[model samples]
Target: MSHIKDVTGGTPIVLESLWKTYANFVAVSGIDLSVGAGRFCTVLGPSGSGKTTTLMMIAGFVAPTRGRILVSGRDIAALPPQKRNLGVVFQNYALFPHLTVFDNVAFPLIMRRVPQAEIAQRVERMLETVELAGLGGRYPRELSGGQQQRVALARALVFEPRVLLMDEPLGALDKKLRSSLQIELKALQRRLDVTVIYVTHDQEEALTMADQIVVMQGGRIEQNGTPEDLYDRPATAFVAGFMGDTNLVRGVVMAADKDGTLRIDHPTGRRIIARASGFQAGDHVAASLRPECLSIESPDGPEEPENAWDGRIAAVTYLGDAIRYHVAVGENRPTLAETLVVKAARRGTEHRRFSEGDAVRVRWSRSDARVLPPTRADARILPPMQAGGH
Candidate 1:
């Protein structure tokens, strides 16, 4: 994608103490955020997490019940949707079926009363930018899902609004197509240098396309950080599990030191040492261990490893690029420890050969274990033996 200079540059957005409440139910609660000029930020969560409602408020489609929405230092909380001069792309692609792609893309320009000749020129340029230059004569019904989505994007961007808001714009496409569009969309955003605030429930999409990710739960912000920060160091158990797959071991602080380290005793009697600041003995905690952070070896391996557990291989799943092994550990109250072996990291034929009933040792470094605040999601703890594996 080629970089296209436009008038949308250099405009930042700020939401100060923003909130929305209808009767006794609250949709969004006290959100404060700032989107830097030309940055891509994503609000991510499960259903009813208020991500979409927050986006609508930013687009002026839903008025804030309290607080301010500032655009480039000017408050636009009272402005109407059209008066805010922001672009919005919805999941449904909101295109006019009766009009040709060209006219549909030019609708915003027409509403703004730009000269007819300029509108035609700008629409044509946008069509070319979105790789739909030759398909402008076709109606929305005649276009493919991807093409129609491109048309909607072109329409929202053709006017060069200061900020572009996308609410699950790629959610309707197939996985392969959605993945392809994600790359193209990120490239297009950088090319245009437009501030984009995206809302989606897909963690993969958020991780792939966002410069910053704000995780929300129960109509409130759970955590906000860069992709790496959120993935490697989640603040809460919900975030640790929600952001990606991980094994959460619930325990209580058996010992604590002033140097930000603590020894946790699991309910199954397994002890784990982890790093957690500002916690004393007897504090409940959960350790989030990524699958890749663990390694498996022979049960009688000579080397002494930290956080080692002996288990019989219960199940193995072969993902395209990696192999996942679910091992059952502990005697009375067992827990499943999931370990991953990357195809590239496989040592030899022996590493690739493993039977379901073979005994193995699962171990991980102490530093890999991230101690976090306990959550309701972790309250239920491990699944029963009959059900097995998380």
Candidate 2:
């Protein structure tokens, strides 16, 4: 197992116009990606977005209709699953029910016909690495979900494969356990320096674990970058809304101010000033503002903000550490229908001051808002409100 550590660092993976097509459906489109050696990269997307399919193609479990999968600059698209030397951990654990934990982790070595003595030694080391040294005799059914997941991970990692592929391996665990495992799994990857191509729809998991994130949608890449790059300055409306809680306000560019800010006219006659790129008067756009950017002020406040608006407190949702105020603005719109969400964190002994039906000012800094092109995802008059704290 000491020698295994030296061999397990990683290998660079490249997908050259990779695609998977079945009759009329294209599961994965032409995707070109370069995953660096020893990097933890997560393929993130919703169901049917081709993220899992791309992962399968990389593992050689699914044959690509076109293009090549390369490892260490060598094409492996035609290689069989066993010859690819890529380890996989599925969501189901995929352990042999009849085998003990030691045997499960040793299965790959056995298949490769490594000496029995070597297999036993390596299995013990891997079990200890995964913090399961004393549970080698336990069967799959006898272990708890988290333990079983660790067993599955141990099995995949024990082979010292060049690349590790995991497909929602912690999906079945409870929330708290899943979070715990996410940390442990990331720590393990760092210690081993393994190249990991993980697939998940969980944005938080992707953000927490991956050094790089590739966001997929409709069989094509929507965006790829470090977590902060994607979250702070998303290039599209979908990315803006999907990555976090944001207000999407549709408007037409009325004019560009001398300071490089654009004046946008909303349908409800509200004018918004925000920073944007590549647009002119008469162009329609959507402005994205994070809830935390907005602040609630009393109606009688001396000086209203530049972007302040008069609104009535519609509803208040209590979060453990913060409160979400749904403030209704614009005439003729229902209280909850066209509301602005303002989130305020609570300091010790601080209490909410406004109640429903109270007049208030919902305002945010002009710099806090970002303007993006109108997207199909925001076809609704007002984009759907996602659950907060993404």
Candidate 3:
């Protein structure tokens, strides 16, 4: 049997071309990844997209149909879950119902036959670390959801395992509670320098907590990078759309200049200049621009010398922090523009200004746009922007 500590000093874990199939159906397909010691890695995807399956395989709950799993440099494909010495925190905060918070945090040490006095000292220190030093005697039923989660976390860390795996551990809490815990958890992980593999379907959670993100779809890795890398420079169309709100425009490449500039001819025959590289003439392409990248203007004046398009305002929405304007440019296509609410309010009264059917111009910087290859069959259009009611 392979040992977990063999790979813990530098390389914490490695999955070599991992594959998991259930009968004839594949759950995880050909995944290769490495988690270095003290790094925070997140596996992000929607449900049944193989993120959970991948986590289970690493934890030894689901045996792989192919490939080997190594903890450090030694192969542990056949090791049992208990033998691997890993800590896991689940979505439900699986603390023993009858045990007090202190006992729950101390259970792992007790199971390994540690002395009672040492367990007490360790448990007390862990409680302080989680800011629950005085709540150790309260049972799971008595503590709030957040408090119980902290106890669960303390339990996982008290064992001093080589790796920590969490499967949507904050999925059950309210938004406010979840956000607070996200910050706490991230700080704790960095302080302890633990190798963490977190699984979640929530994009915000992954972006908030992970040092590196691995996006999965259909049992395969779609993309992997730092949060900024994925957000600012998505390598694929799916990555761009999935990461956040983006405006995608389809056009034919009119020119591929030497300075990574692309001149595209939209379907309406309007030309737009954008930033891109590595494309041939006559190639079909798509450009992704964030809503905040576009600025709006009245159409009556002489046209502003900008990358501007004329469109009719389809709708206006006031989202406390910002105003979202949906501009109808052509048949069945609308571009969204957003501005700070403070700026919109300074312009004029809400009801009298910028109503639907008003002609307007949408302008954006060429540098704010990214040109990419046209999306494949699986690419999905962004959700329509919700207008704030007047």
Candidate 4:
């Protein structure tokens, strides 16, 4: 595997006000992004969210309806695909059926008219890099799915292209294989010192592999930041719900303390405290809290915390690693809370376990709650769950 220091220098790729539209439908709407040289940047979004279209435009496969694509300040919008010095690995391998692994990897070098000896040396080295050295003589059909994908990867890297573009290259593989290849591909990209623009709809894959993530929604960028930044402080309601599971509590602000505390009145008649950085009293707000930030405690556990709310256990689901508990307040929708299975089991034995009708208290820290604008100030609250229904 190549070390990060081995490939840290190169020219950055910039997308300036890029846009793509088909007839009346806009696919990518004025996206501006700059990818640092030798960094792994992932474009993440759901299907039909313009991630693929943006990638295609960058690869020169689809010409943009408007805007500019630059490489190290050079305008390459009109450049042919082959002339742009890029390596592309599509979802479908795109390997030549008649060519052996060696020939497949050597194709790029051959096109450049490299000497036969040099081509063999470069192809052999690439094969070793992808851990497919001995299988170079085998046809694509003879190799396993993972091995074939590795050959495709080696082919893309053998020619030492200036930039690499991968469009869901692991989308066709099984989960286990996909995870293994993601680590391998990230390591390889670092070793090769090549700029990479990766596109995927899988949030886990993007969070795990990317140095920076550009989250897209409805043909526009919702947020762009490091994984921790987006996870800890989501900038919008869509980002909070889309990135991970979040509990949204709709309420009206009752008071804003000078010490940065916000008192809010929930529709359920419960009061909660959140940060009051950008909000004022009498304003409507929505608070987003992660399930992991909440916990179910006994009614008699202790004095209520600053942000604790008393509720009844509505439902409990036992996932393999954790137990998910749904707690219902007076009239608000039940909020989900996840706890480690071991902890939940111990609590069940030592304390009054949260049965179908058990009373409990959900608590979190004020710092963990994120307050933002409400979805709709005039939206009506849905009916609360019945005794045994969550």
Question: TM-score of each candidate?
Answer: 0.88, 0.88, 0.83, 0.83
Off by over 4 Å in 1: 1-9, 301-305, 332-344, 348-351, 376-390
CA lDDT of every candidate: 0.80, 0.82, 0.77, 0.77
Tens digits of per-residue lDDT, candidate 1, 62-136, equal 877776788887778778888888889988747998999999999999999999999989999899877788898
What lDDT score is found at residue 47 in candidate 4?
81
List the pairs of residues colliding in candidate 2. Answer: none
Across residues 95-175, which tens digit of lDDT does each residue of candidate 3 receive? 999899999999999989999999999999989977799998889999887778778889998978768999888877789
- Could you give candidate 4's per-residue lDDT for residues 104-129 as a string of tens digits? 99999999999999998989988987
**Cα error of candidate 3 at position 25, Å:** 1.6
Report the number of backbone clashes for model 4.
0
Clashes of 3: 2
> Which is better, 1 or 3, measured by lDDT?
1
Residue 247 CA error for candidate 3 (Å)?
A: 1.1
RMSD of each: 8.3, 7.5, 8.6, 9.5
| Global Cα lDDT for candidate 1 | 0.80
lDDT of 4: 0.77
